[model samples]
Target: MVISVKLLEGKKVAQALDETMAKRVESLKEKGITPGLAVVLVGDNSASAVYVRNKQRRAEKLGINFQLIRFEESVTEQELLAKIDELNNDSAIDGFLVQLPLPDHIDEDKVNEAISPNKDVDGFTPISVGNLWIGTPMTKPATASGILMMLDHYNVDLDGKNVVIIGRSNIVGKPTAALMLERNATVTITHSHTKNLKEITSKADVLVVAIGRAKFITQDYVKDQAIVIDVGMDRDENGKLCGDVDFDDVKDKTSMITPVPGGVGPMTITALVDQVIELAEGRING
Candidate 1:
């Protein structure tokens, strides 16, 4: 029996979200409210720059206001906090985020904490994360929300299923497990230290891989027809982009899977944009 696989493309899911956002933007504009998103990018991280550019492009295309606040690598932490404070009070600003991986001198936690939870569209603040974990979500972490969108888009049912997630990062892995559990699936989180990782992963009815290593979960780690979602954006030996799952090796073994460039990546930014709209509408239910 030859079972065909479904590739869950983020581009398509993002397009669907784009249409929804466009309508919402138009409605808000009629009421004299233009949703705005401010992104604070510190230093010169190439990956962060690319991500910011992608976000600005998408925002502009949707007619949403996008502000890119650039800071030098040598900028002081106090300086960033001051700027965040200003944006917090700015009435026009609906949502904002400080891009991660600040330089060694700055405290990432301090910056995240400084941003008003009311304007914390990144959903990294203690208040936001806490709200999400307990099920009454005010705002969700973008990547995790995006993963849920993928599951919904592909019609993958999670109820009563064993969902295994790799890499327990705050932004992706942990929040995703929480979201899956909200959907009634039993979730297990594994990291670098887990014993017999494959033994654990192979038991999953749905597998999500966000471990930083490129192409880490090959065919052996997955069960037959299990839906796979790759949350990694990594480079291969040839300097080409890849994901946490080895798409070439594992695609045929799954019922559905998300690819590297077009998988969870696009949905993440889209989810961020959605938060802005939700904030403007006074409907921030995560």
Candidate 2:
């Protein structure tokens, strides 16, 4: 007897999410509320450009008003903070986020603090994170929220499951742990210096890897029939795009797994639009 493994494609999951939100987006427009999202880019980083472009494209498709505010590398921290204040006060904008990896001169934490919690669709602000921990989150961090949406769509029950997340970055791991805990899953987060990494990972019912390594989590690290979510975007030795998990090596061993390019990538941007729509709706109701 053979157990057939399943692939959880993120592109399809993202599409389904967008489809569900399409009518809601149009409904906002029907009521004279056009959801708006703005992305502020401090410098021209290649990776940040790719993310911004993806968000812009998806926002247009979903009928959300999107804007990219580009600033030179020399832009001062004061200038960036002031701009965030402006956007926060701008009634047209429902939500906004400053693209990460801003110039070294700018204090990233301070910038996040400057964005109004109501408009922080990226959910990086202290207020947003605090809300999440208190069990009454307003807008979730997009990537983490997107991952949860994917898991929920696939009917992956989180109750009482052991979830081990291998990246502790604020954008992915920490928030994701909070979400799993919300679902009654026991969560453990491992970072760069984690000892006996494989031993811990092998016990997880669900594994999510986002450590920015290429093919780092192989068959040895994953438990049999575990659900794997790969949040990495990396290039293999042959210049082929791959995930942190070696999909070919680990796919057969897992009950379900998400691929790199078509997996978690698509859902990130879709979640952004969903947050903007929610913010816009709230504004209208208030």
Candidate 2 to native Cα RMSD, angstroms: 1.2
Candidate 2 lDDT score relative to the true structure: 0.91
For residues 190-282, what per-residue lDDT tens digits would candidate 1 score against the true structure?
998999999999999899998888998999999998889898989999999999889999999998999889999999988888888888887
Instruction: Give lDDT: candidate 2, residue 122.
Output: 93
RMSD of each: 2.0, 1.2
What are the Cα lDDT values of the candidates?
0.89, 0.91
What lDDT is reached at residue 266 by model 2?
A: 86
TM-score quality measure for candidate 1: 0.95
lDDT tens string, model 2, 14-43? 888888788898988889999999999978
Which sections of candidate 2 miss by over 4 Å?
A: none
Could you give me the TM-score of model 2 versus the true structure? 0.96
Residue 123 CA error for candidate 2 (Å)? 0.8
